[model samples]
Target: MGGSLPRSVDDLPLLPDLVAPQAWSADLVAASDGLFERGVRVLRDGEGGLLVIGDAVMRALAQDPAVGGTPVEFLTGRAGDRVRRATGAAPPSGAAAFDAFLRNQVFTMNAALHVAVRRVVARHLVPRAVLGMAGHAERVLVGVLDEVTRVGGVVDLERDVAGPYVTRFWTDQLGVPAGAALRVQQLVHEMNRMFLFAPTLEDRARVLAATEEYLELVGRTVAMAWERGDNALLGHLARGLDGIDLPGAPPDLGALVAANFFDGFHTVAVAVANAARCLLADAPAAERVRRAPSLVAAAFTEGARLTAPLMLTTRMALGDVEHAGLRIPAGTPITMAWIAANRDPEAYDEPGGYRLDRPPRLGTTFGGGARICPGRGATRMLGEVALRALTATSVQVRLESPQPGWVPGSAIRRHPAIPVVVRRVAAA
Candidate 1:
């Protein structure tokens, strides 16, 4: 279909209109497959930008310096801002701070800024540091599991277990006072909605409100840590930010906190839910994990490969690049369909199978290349802890329905309700 770049983006094949809405509510994987069957490795997305499918192209795009992390709007356009203004969703108070927070986030930065922020975040989130938190993560998960089993009935895994477990883990990890954990979780949850694929004015308004409060909360938390000399992750972050230089002036402490904590929580929570769902569905795998708890890590990795937490991520082209016999011009926005890439037949054998023996990072779930997710280590560590504790528990989970119910239109893949019946197994 491609000889040279299309004369215009409109000249390319268009993605189905329903892909975005259905992506979160239904099967994003199916939509990805449909694109492949039509031989649409690269297509024009009606919403905006060029949509890229297939493993090779997606990986090449992700790794290319010309294809970057900043959203196209920030790079070249502001359509969403125009729409928000037209809808009378005036800029919220602290809009400057909000914008700064987004710009400072590892996801939105590019070039020098991206490198600087990633370096700082990496120091704190390295695999060794994340692994050190394993004991605490295990305790949090075990407590949550015990509470869930004590209730003893049908449970929504996402709502009842994964959500609270993550909330508690992050709250503890961040050195949040026990009393404030719930509020911190609420603020992070609200802030996370801003990551949705396309938010209405109402959604933006809600996000603005939550982000404002969340920033204030971070300020107070940092202040308290300084006052008390709290020796937790938040304190480490606070100490770490001292005198750090960036492209612009250094980002506010709150921006750094939000960048590290909120982003990690979103993907990790989804990974936990997806991993748990996969384990519950695969009896032989679950049994093997149960027999050798060490296999829990592999099980978590396989689960993430099957259903990535983030279905897709968009990048703006810094310069023209050629891929698949097509010339993508500079400033063109490109959407990398990670869900499709993870399951690409060319990338994995029996892509649908729950095989733990596969090589590491075979999937695009956490993305790849220069912008591979910085929180990937932490995500896996947390997922492994949750799964290990689940296997060790005297509890059993079976799907109440054969299929899961997913949250609608979210940029992040999430299960709103994985209804499961729980039975406590008598200990041997």
Candidate 2:
């Protein structure tokens, strides 16, 4: 966990007791401004920790020649050397390995997206005849809805469903044994638990166990593809997993699974829920999206911009850097405040307003540069599917309670539970 700082100087006077005393220091405030000016990827002070802000800097670190094309590692307390080795160095590059990794990643991401879209379309849109697809979309939606209802109200949206869905889809695409898919699902669940839920030492151990199991499966799948001289499979896996260094890490499986989960499920799910909340709060916005299915993506993007799930990203200064006429010394910790940056008055017109048709403003939701999220396209597609389903259905969403709020201490903004009453509309 990291210390908290006020969103801006104006909020400094309201620092709560939970905020780290050091977070209110003058040097940190100056560094925050300097980070905005330099457009550097990372900013740090004397402490060597970092706040990663600028897209330019983020891109540079991702493509840094010094690391052989690896993103700069953000060093944390007592973990500098370990973190450096894990993220600061690049993977062994050979044509064969790199190609395979890339291909595998594409296949996995596409497969995951496919499942997500299908889930939404079948469950929400098809039944309502919103997209006019033939066949029994209603049956499919009913099956899932019935199952969910039977299972009770408590659903682990990320773990019990989305994680398993992606893992199964990915494994099937890669021709891996079906049994191993469960291990992947467990890995995904544990990682989400660790990073996004009640993070604890025991939770971490579960993550490690799941990771080991997944790696064994991935390793076997990779070897089998190679032995069969399957060029396509080899190339995909190589490219997808290329440059990932996991030496001395708790468990390679856990980290990789975690990465995939983060890329695929976490962001998209949160975005979907949050976007729905936004629409429900503003009737005009909801009507705009409902009237035009083509505008779903735009609406989602606007919602994301307004309430960026991630609050901040971190980076450490590798050396002294000058930004906006201020000098930031080597080893400083820099925090890139995404929530603030997305709302910057200079960057966004009517910063607080959510207008779907507005021109795209370059923002850091999926990050930028070499480390920019590779699964961004797929995630967007997933969001589109969810929106399409929700809008197509004639279910009226009424706020049973006050508008939902976000949970703190998370790297991303998340809605714990959105209690809304869904009443099916009478047939027109």
Candidate 3:
């Protein structure tokens, strides 16, 4: 939000690269502090360079059209050019290559195009009847939790509850086959590597191979939608709604289907896990949620605020732009620091600590302004349902292991398998 991206590491003090894949949450917290303490809103971090932080700077990114026009057109998307120069292997194609032209298609289309597609996507996510939809998710989640507790309350919460719970919701609403949720989750993880810090040739090649299989699965589900014929997510999208025109609907509906699946699954699952982990840590909040089910939505937002599922986003400069008084030239690489902005002290009280009473409206956890995530409503609903169900279980959620064995990825902080034990209340 602060300024145009620094062209090179030399543009500013060689601040520790906050965007590096190996970099942990601690690194980001320290880096955010240094940037604000030193009064530099932008710096190139290790692995992934040229990060913009601070609330004022993020505001600049939102208001200025140049910073966000098309994500891949900017310096960040030139990994292929770098690959050709280094390895002599041809760059990837299709979704694997993270094609420059498609970047513009991803977000920065004309206002009309954004409106047309967004309407369709938003309908499923932010339904007119919130209580009705949330009730369905809650019912499904209760069934899932009952099954898990029946077998034994000891299970990997990340995989068993967070994922399968949401997966069942999609299946019920979209009318897809049962047990395909884990497969979708695996494919989305591979596909998301493209957005991480300069994915290696191996990563690109792997995604290229998976893209074929991934699209095949999306097609299978689309066919499944034909069988179900319900007004769920896949059904509604496959036939193409009346108002959405040709351009609004993707020529390749499978690809669009895959994209929509990607949008909600990982982010929502991670948010669910994070909230559970937070509530476990703060038992008081967990107990409060148990007493008042309505507080689940606020807890979900807080969980995302603490640990953003998608931490960093890359944007390119369309032309020379001044941010926080620094001139970033055309074609410079700029990384948007969603994680750092979420923790900005100016924006929230006790930004570091877990505060259930903290305002839910702060930070870019789901993004800000026009760039706000469309899946936000769905994410919150899924999380609320899952957490709400947990409160009713009359059990204590404790970490299976002392350590949070977080999975390493390009940009995403994933909760792959969280071993947790839920002690049931027999007296109840």
**Which candidate wins on lDDT?**
1
Clashing pairs in 1: none
Q: Higher TM-score: candidate 2 or 3? A: 3
Off by over 4 Å in 2: 1-47, 50-186, 193-210, 213-235, 239-262, 329-333, 394-401, 420-427
Question: Residue 265 of candidate 1: its Cα lDDT?
Answer: 54
**Candidate 3 C-alpha RMSD relative to the actual structure:** 4.2
Q: How do the predictions measure up, each by TM-score? A: 0.88, 0.59, 0.82
Q: Where does candidate 1 stray beyond 4 Å?
A: 1-11, 17-26, 71-97, 421-426
What lDDT does the true structure give each of the candidates? 0.72, 0.45, 0.64
Cα deviation of 91, candidate 2, in Å:
28
Q: What is the lDDT of residue 249 in candidate 3?
A: 47
Relative to the true structure, candidate 2 has a C-alpha RMSD (angstroms) of 10.9
Candidate order by lDDT, decreasing, is 1, 3, 2
Query: Compared with the true structure, what per-residue lDDT tens digits does model 1 show for residues 222-274?
Result: 55655676656656665566656656534565567755567665567778988
TM-score order of candidates, top first: 1, 3, 2
Best by TM-score: 1
Q: Give candidate 1's error at residue 401 in angstroms.
A: 2.6
